[model samples]
Target: MNFANACRLTLLAAIWGASFLFLRLAVPSLGPIWTISARIGLAAVFLALVAQALKQGFAWQHWREYLILGIFNTALPFLAYGFAARTLNASMMSILNATAPIWGAVIMALIIRKMPTFKVCLGLLIGILGVAILVGFDRVVSQTGAALGIATCLSATLCYGIASAYTKLKASHIPSFQVAHGSMWGASLFLLPLFATSQPISTPTPVVWLAIAGLAILCTGAAYLLYFRLVREIGAASTLTVTFLIPVFGILWGTLFLGEHIGSNTLIGALIILLGTALVTGFNPLASRK
Candidate 1:
């Protein structure tokens, strides 16, 4: 990656990292349905404005792909995260989020009916180890709601994995902006009934509203711009490294803003997870052997 792209990558990681913090603040108040629905809904509106400013237009035929992505990628995953945020700290949530690529590999293996490379198999195992270390250290298994929260977080990442594979298999031809915009709308649609039934809307404090704005506008909408730009400028493989850095900033943001614990075990587990993901995606130069 060039210096500019490197900068963009770092910014993208920071934005995504902050997303966990936003969820930590907003989800409990808004409830999963309203919180996640507002997030994608507002982000879709922002992206639409930007698209109009850029004189860009997309075809309506991509509705089917939008629905698929909306369900697996946006609606389901965001719903899971909303449930998880009630108990999981921002740092812990980010660590679990790193498992998406590992899940993606497993999904790909199942879809293809073939074994993954040795490195990939090793990565998958280490990724599991990373999760074990975290859950063990946190004693999430023993906690009441925390265990279920962790499970929801894992399910959320699994949804992300499914979305990635589905995108590659069926919708790779669609433009990133279209998929992002349409999928957000799709997710909003999916969450509409849930939003109505889950909770009555209440006036949020100013702080909560700020968190909502950041979550929807900055974390989701603006982050997509940086991500898509990096994918176009650098190869997607290079852009993928941002995933490793996201947890780093996630921990940092949690500590600085929310005063969440950033224990040694959190750092160690997150490092292992990122390392395993690097191996899975061929991000490790030292492990590149014939």
Candidate 2:
């Protein structure tokens, strides 16, 4: 890629990384389900307007696929991350989220009937080891909630992995922006009942509303636009690099703005996770074999 595109990619990464911070800020005021629903719903609106203005052909041609994508790509993962952030630091949650691509490769191999390459196998091993270390540290310190939060993040990432694979194989034909809009609409539908039952409106504050606005406009809407553009320009692997950068930006932002510490083990694990992901996603042994 050229220098401009590289900078754009980095900016996209920063936007996504900042999302963890915003989620941390927003979730405390607005509960997880409602927050996710609102932001994604707003994002959908933005996408809808853009699509209409552009005269883009739009339809939920495959309702089932859109539903599945909504669940895997946005609904499940978004809720998981939002809920987990209540218990875990954004730094920790973002670090754990870097596992999405690792899980995605495995899911792709299984569902698509492609065999797992050595790089993917190695990445799986490394990722598990890194997670075990995090869990072990938490267990020894009696921070069980943090461990569970990380596990929640992993579950979300697993969904992301499956969704990533599925999107690349099945939804590539659709414009990425349209896919984003459709997924957001589906997610909004799934989340509406939960938001109402959870009774978030009764509990929300002005700060919460402001947080929701930033989360919707800056993080979800703008970030997704950049993300879709990056994926179309550079393909999925390059797009997924934002996964690694998110944690770094999360930790830095948390430290700077929230007075959170950068623990040694967290840094070490982050490095290992990134290295493993790079090995898995950046190089394909199958391609070389072919």
Candidate 3:
């Protein structure tokens, strides 16, 4: 990779990694429903403006697929992560997010009605072990809702896996930018009624507003643009390397900004989980060139 593309990849990872930090900061004050609703809603607006600027148009005929993608990819997972952010630290949540591709492999296998190969099976076992280690040893388990929080985070990743499979099965023909743009709007609409009824736990301060803007604009909207661009420029397999880098930035942001502690267990579990993800996805930077 050239230096410019490498820089874009790193920047994308840093932006996505900071999303957890923003969720943790905003969710307590905004509540999960309101926080996620605002996030997708604002992100939709941002992407719409970008689309207009680029003279891009939507595929209105594919609205149904967009809604399904929105539900699984944007609304459900984002809401789950928002809820998880209430009790889990940003570091742990980011690490758990890495499990999405592992879940994807299993889901795709079931979709195809085929048994997983030995390598995938081994990856699945190791992935589960990593989660066990991370949750079993983390001090956050002492918190009241931490168990549910971890489960919620896992469910979010499962939603991501489902979305990936669905996209491959039914929506792969749509351009990535169109899918992203349309789904954000779909998610915003899906969450509208709930957002209307929900109230924030407390009045949001400027910090919360800033966090929401960063989450919606940078993390959701701009990150999608960068992601699709990298896919076009470098190919999707190479772009997947961002998955391995996200947790590093997640841990760094949490420690430096949120003052979250990183135990030995966190490092070990992260390494194991990443290893399993690499195995399951067959992601290799060197091989991607072939």
Candidate 4:
């Protein structure tokens, strides 16, 4: 990869990684439903403007598909993470995000009615072990609602896995940008009623508004654009390297900005999870270089 693409990859990771921090900052005041609603709502607006600027129009006929994708891919997972952010540290949530591919492999295997390969099975086991270590040993476990938060985050990753499998099964023909843009709109609509019915626990201060903007614009909207560009230029596998990089930035941002402590379990669990992910995806850095 060229130095510029490499930098883009790192920047993408950093932006996405910082999403957890934004969630942690924003969710307390806005609450999960409102936080995620505003996030998808604002991101939809941003992507709409970008789509217009690029003269790309939506395929309105595919609104049903977009709704399904939006619920599974955007709305559910974002809501789950937003809920979890209230109880879990940004670092922990980021590490848990890495489990999406593992869940994807399992979902795919079940969908095809075939067993996973030995490597994948082993990776799945190792990944579970890593999550156990991370959650069981972490200091957060003692906090109220932490267990539920962990479960919520895991459910979020499971939603991502379901979305991936669903895309491959039903929506592969749709362009990536269209899927992203349409889904944000879909998610916004999905969450609109929920946001309307629910009230924020506290009024949002300016900093909270800033956090919401960062989450919506930088982390969700711009990050998707950057991710798709990397996919086009470097192929999906190399672009996926961003997955491994995300948790590193997640932990760093949590530590540096939020003053969240990273115990040894965090490091050990993250490494194990990434190793399991590498095995499951068969992602090799050396192969990408060629």
Candidate 5:
């Protein structure tokens, strides 16, 4: 927890937090498929240039691995969250996204054939409770995007969590930068046909291009670099803490820039979700051993 890593944490939080806002802006102009495609495409190009400059030529040794990561981590989750955000508020979407660690823990347990630590199991239960509290009552009491939007957010997180477990396993042998670059390029390729069908360029604007640029340079490129650095400096648990702060800035930007409303339920849900994340990432049954 050095001062420098702390600052990096804050920077990563702000950058990712603002990602939802960028999506919101770009989606209106370009639609979800195109907006996401543009970002991943641009990010791939930028990362490729950087890698070449650093003498890291494109490595296709694990093209299959990168392709899977791209599909799960980049394409599927991005589209799910993007479409979901059209209906769900930023705060709510972020709250749901925070459940990634819980999903990760569960996936790990399943894949590794080892019992999750007690604390991890408990954290999973608590996280589920929080999601229920957030979405259950809303679904029962209202018809305002409670089902579709919430489902999208949770599904997106599920993809993220599964991808995370896979990344942890595969990235053990792959160069981290190559992983990032390959994932971006694979995502771009996956989205290309969809982008072609939608064809956002048919009705483009300068603002839309700017949104794509921000998504590419800031959210995708810069964010991934800091993400890796933060993981190294703070460990995965602390690095993922950025997820908690992302929603705060996302909600703020949504309200300030997009004029989106912040509902009372959304705020309550956010608090509960943060509590769940804290439990999942910070808790350890074996803490006494340390």
Candidate 6:
């Protein structure tokens, strides 16, 4: 990778990593519906303006497709994760979110009616073990949260898995920016009724307001731009290494900003989870030794 892409990787990872912290801070003040609504709403407007300026605006040729994609990709996941953020800390949520790729593999296998390679099967097992470790020691034993929080976080990742596979099958031809723009708008519109009925605007402290704005603009908007740009520069496969780095910064930001505790179990489980993820994604270090 070039130096520029390296910087992109670092910045992208930091931006996304900080998302968990932002959600943790904002969710309490805005609540899930308003928080996610404002996030997707703001991101959509920002992306739309940029697209119009560049004359590369989203083509609404597939509104239905965008609607479905937005539901899975943005609306549902953000809502579920927002709710989970109330109970789960930034580090825990980030770690669980990494399970999205594993869920994607499971979803694909079911769709194709074929099992993964035995190596990938092993990776899946290790990933499950990692989750068990986190649940058993990090939260369940410590009583930081109950099963509901963990379940919601995992469910958010399930939405991610479904959205990813759906996008690949249905909307691969669309530019990434267009896809993000259309999906954000679709999600914002989809949540409008809920936002109106259930979401009351509350006065948060200026710090919380900053958190909400940062969550919307920086985490959602700029993060997407960085992600798509990296995909363009480095190819998608290499760009995915950002996944491994995300949790690192997630833990860091949580520790530094939120003053969240990072237990030994958190570190160990995260390492195991990333190892399994690497295997699932076709990383084979042992092969190099041979």
For model 1, residues 1-290, the per-residue Cα lDDT tens digits are: 55777788889999999999998888767777788888888998999999899888966899999988999998999889888888888899988999998898889989999999999999988888888888788744465799889999999999999999999999999999889888888888888888777772466777777888999999999998888888887767777787888888998999999988666777788888888887787785433211
Cα deviation of 74, candidate 1, in Å: 0.9
lDDT of 1 at 82: 88
Q: Assess each prediction's global lDDT (C-alpha) against the native.
A: 0.86, 0.77, 0.95, 0.94, 0.79, 0.84
Q: Which lDDT tens digits does candidate 5 get at residues 1-290?
A: 77888788878887787888777677766778888887898999999888888888888888898899999999999998778766666656766878887787788889999997776777777777778777765432265655787888888888988898998887667877888989998898888889888855357678778878888999999899889877776676667668777878877877888787666766777777777777767744244122
Maximum-lDDT candidate: 3
Which runs of model 6 end up more than 4 angstroms from their true locations?
A: 139-145, 284-290
lDDT score for candidate 6 against the true structure: 0.84
- Judged by whole-model lDDT over C-alpha atoms, candidate 1 comes out at 0.86
Number of clashing pairs per prediction, in order: 0, 0, 0, 0, 0, 0
Q: What lDDT, from 0 to 1, does candidate 3 have? A: 0.95
For model 1 the local lDDT of residue 27 reads 76
Q: Any runs in candidate 5 off by more than 4 Å, and if so which? A: 136-146, 283-290
lDDT of 6 by residue, 214-256 (tens): 8888989889988999889777777778778889999999999
Better of 2 and 5 by lDDT: 5
* lDDT of candidate 3 at residue 78, scale 0 to 100: 98
Q: Worst lDDT window (10 residues) for model 3?
A: 281-290
What TM-score against the true fold does each predicted structure earn? 0.95, 0.90, 0.98, 0.99, 0.89, 0.94
* Per-model root-mean-square deviation over C-alphas: 2.3, 3.4, 0.9, 0.8, 3.2, 2.5
lDDT of 2 by residue, 1-290 (tens): 55766777778777777778878888877778878988888877887887788787667686666777888999999999988877787777778888888888888888869878787788888888777665555422355566667778889999998898888888877777777778888888888888778846357777667767877877787788888787777766566667767887888877887677676677877878877777777645344222
| Stretches of candidate 3 exceeding 4 Å from the true structure | 288-290
Better of 4 and 5 by lDDT: 4
Candidate 1 vs 6: which has more lDDT: 1
